[model samples]
Target: MRRYPEIGKFTLKVYYEKDPEVRADIQKSIAKYADFKQNVKQLNFDSSQFVPGIDIEMMYNDMYWASEGYIWEKIQDEKYDVDMMERDFLKMVDFWKSIYLRKEGEHDEGN
Candidate 1:
């Protein structure tokens, strides 16, 4: 699992290319799934910072079918669904692992 240095307050950052068509499509899709505004460029879910909590951040890219994204959380205890935390941790690990492996001539293994 991957861990980032704690930043005091929980914050999620999503980055995407600036594209109008792609941005519009993402807005429409999110609106269809939930009550979201068309102009909403960013979304934040505020939840308890205690252990076993999740925070989601989403971003859209004009040229990519899957939106680029990230999630950040502070895990404290195992009383909650720590599996979710582990999953997120693995995702973060996989991201950097892939990059490093690629640069080091190691097999990406279908990554």
Candidate 2:
């Protein structure tokens, strides 16, 4: 995670990993971040101040591209099962929301 003051931007970059599981986790995190940012936007919140929306970008190596049995690879295909990805993203978002609510001393009813 990195924040640039000059540009008033936040970004998260994940380096390519040899382990398929790790890569998948990184992808899930990115998805969660995107969902959380969108939810924030929908709430009419100022992301540039309250959240300062993050740009999540991923890097993949040749090894990942060559994989035939990896879940990440399956996710890239249009016909693949996407429930796993959605579940992971939602789970991550829930966990983060819990933490944020705790920090802010707010109830998690609507969140």
Candidate 3:
């Protein structure tokens, strides 16, 4: 981020850390970019590298990063029924296709 100093890191961690053995075994897999950069590789998740979709202005209209309602938990909370989920799945496909990297001969498409 250009202003990481102003906005501290908001890391989204989604994994298990049960015990010391797990920590030792999965340290490499779970390591964040910052920790890896500090200890192993000097790489960063620079904000400039991420090119958001043109439709990002209406990003709220879609749920490409909706991790909540899709996961299995102690209590079930499915936001979409089977048919609705099917339709949303198609929309999700279209959304990804709209912004995916275009090939050499490909022209601009919807985003």
Candidate 4:
């Protein structure tokens, strides 16, 4: 029989109004977490695997207009479906930010 080592996992869900201001606020919170994580490493808990696994999903707010203008242009040129484009783009932004933080931690560990 093969055995697998237990792995740590954390799951978090943050739901808030879909306004740009709200999203901006969430972004700020994530930035703060990034700063905290950096500080922790500086104090030397410096394990190569110290990067925390983070996942966030934002509920789509119909009231918020993500793309104001160029809607048609986006649909025609970029083939972005008007209905899903904005929300998808924002989710992608959040995903990338998490990736950046993870890589930053990895860099701090010299791994």
Top model number, lDDT: 2
Residue by residue across 57-90, what tens digits does model 3's lDDT show?
A: 2332334234224323311432324455557667
On residues 1-111, what C-alpha lDDT tens digit does candidate 2 reach at each position? 113322311111133345787788877765643453454455564333222223321111222233323544543453543466557557755654453323444343555
Sort all candidates by TM-score, best to worst. Answer: 3, 2, 1, 4
- Name the TM-score of candidate 2: 0.27
Candidates 3 and 4 compared by TM-score, better number: 3
**In order, what is each prediction's RMSD in angstroms?**
16.7, 15.8, 14.4, 15.5
Which regions of candidate 1 deviate over 4 angstroms? 1-72, 75-80, 103-111
Candidate 3 similarity to native, TM-score: 0.28
Query: After best superposition, candidate 1 residue 11: deviation in angstroms?
Result: 23
User: lDDT of each model, Cα atoms only?
Assistant: 0.36, 0.41, 0.40, 0.40
Candidate 1: lDDT over CA atoms?
0.36
Kindly provide the TM-score of model 1 when superposed on the true structure, using C-alpha atoms: 0.23
**For model 4, where is the 10-residue window of minimal lDDT?**
4-13
Task: List, residue by residue over 1-111, the lDDT tens digit for candidate 4.
Answer: 013112111111122325787778776765643443344555453234324543211111111233323343453443344346557667866765455345542554333
